[model samples]
Target: MRKNFLHFLIFIFVFCFSSFSKSETCGGADGLVCCNTITSTSGSVCAIPANNKYIFTLRRFGFENSAGEVTWVGTETSFNAALSSVGASMGNFISGQSLPEGTYVAVRPEVKLEMTVNGSGVSTSDSVACTSGGDQTENLATVMNNLSDPIPNCSSSPNEDCNTGDGYMRIRDTQLGNFTVTAATARTINFEFDVGSGVLFTASGGNCAFRSMGPLDVTMSFSN
Candidate 1:
């Protein structure tokens, strides 16, 4: 009887330890979605198909006002491995939300749109307003400035996405540096992001319009 009780207690300890040691896998929505900016002659893209394990949906949209384009293209790239790697390493991947630990997805989708605004939408010299997300939308310039270099109140200011100056822009997962993807599904890097903006840019000012670039619902998948 004594031996049986000791064995039972040992079993329970091992069981609990094993369960606690297991790393949570991906399955449901990780809750955080990040977006990176890329310039395109085609135009702004919103959504990309969710077929790739790591999906990086690229969109190109410039801010416009009644006067003209408030924001112009500085730079753009469709294939950025290093940036994607940083994305892959970060982000919450659980068993219920997001992809599984070793799951392999193989399709990439892309969409485009544009953001046009007015003079009132931008704020050139309002530090207090720019710092506050609530007061940043005074005009197209303010909105674009806020998007690229928002002066928000947080332990860390000026999110990583906007750290890089110039035409370069990116919005990464908020969970970055706090989350990790398992080595199994981490073999290939996949990324995805959704962004919205109402900022315009121009040397001076003119009638702003992105018109319509239609949608390029293209699907791309790779099998391992």
Candidate 2:
């Protein structure tokens, strides 16, 4: 009997130690780190605008299982997430939505491809400055589809273009990291937009006549 009791105690110690180690390695209040970074290479030079705004519509939020199936939750919502040197949040779009008790391998978010970016850029040819006027909304789907097409001039001016009145829309599926949900668990998910090097400026017709979207870094963090 004494030997059996000793073995049980050893098992408990091992279990606790394993759990603690996992928690430490994860390095968050919760045991999961669901962070993802996204980038694009559409521009020659990357920069951060003085006042950058990334606007998009959150069509749906869901979770992916190990078998690559998604279970969706939440309603459609629009978010105008302003990004800066520090980064910005899109708020809790999934609030009040409950997920079934299960382990999810990834997060799937359906968003509109239409996004608006507000920033400034300089032309490398003649050191000319360019602006999107105030904000330029473009369809990423269109841009992606027509990669070889010539970039439209922001204005008719030879030196600078500042038209900024374009809009388009499409839907896209974005998948982030993995997480698990239980009946007793309370989760907090944060969508961080890092635009440190997101704006791009290019020369057109020997002048700073075009301003286009650049690389963007997005991070999604989950905690309790």
Off by over 4 Å in 1: 1-76, 79-143, 146-160, 175-178, 181-224
Lowest-lDDT window of 10 residues in candidate 2?
Answer: 1-10
Worst ten-residue run, lDDT, model 1?
A: 1-10
Q: What is residue 182's positional error in candidate 1, in angstroms?
A: 5.1
Q: Candidate 1 residues 90-132, lDDT tens each?
A: 2211111232222122221111112211112222221111111
TM-score of 1: 0.21
How high is each candidate's TM-score?
0.21, 0.56
User: How does candidate 1 score on lDDT?
Assistant: 0.21
Residue clash pairs of candidate 2: none
Model 2: lDDT equals 0.41
Tens digit per residue, CA lDDT, model 2, 17-125: 0100010111112221111111222233324442346566666665666666667755677654443212112233443444565666766565666677675543243
- RMSD to the hidden true structure, all candidates: 21.7, 16.3
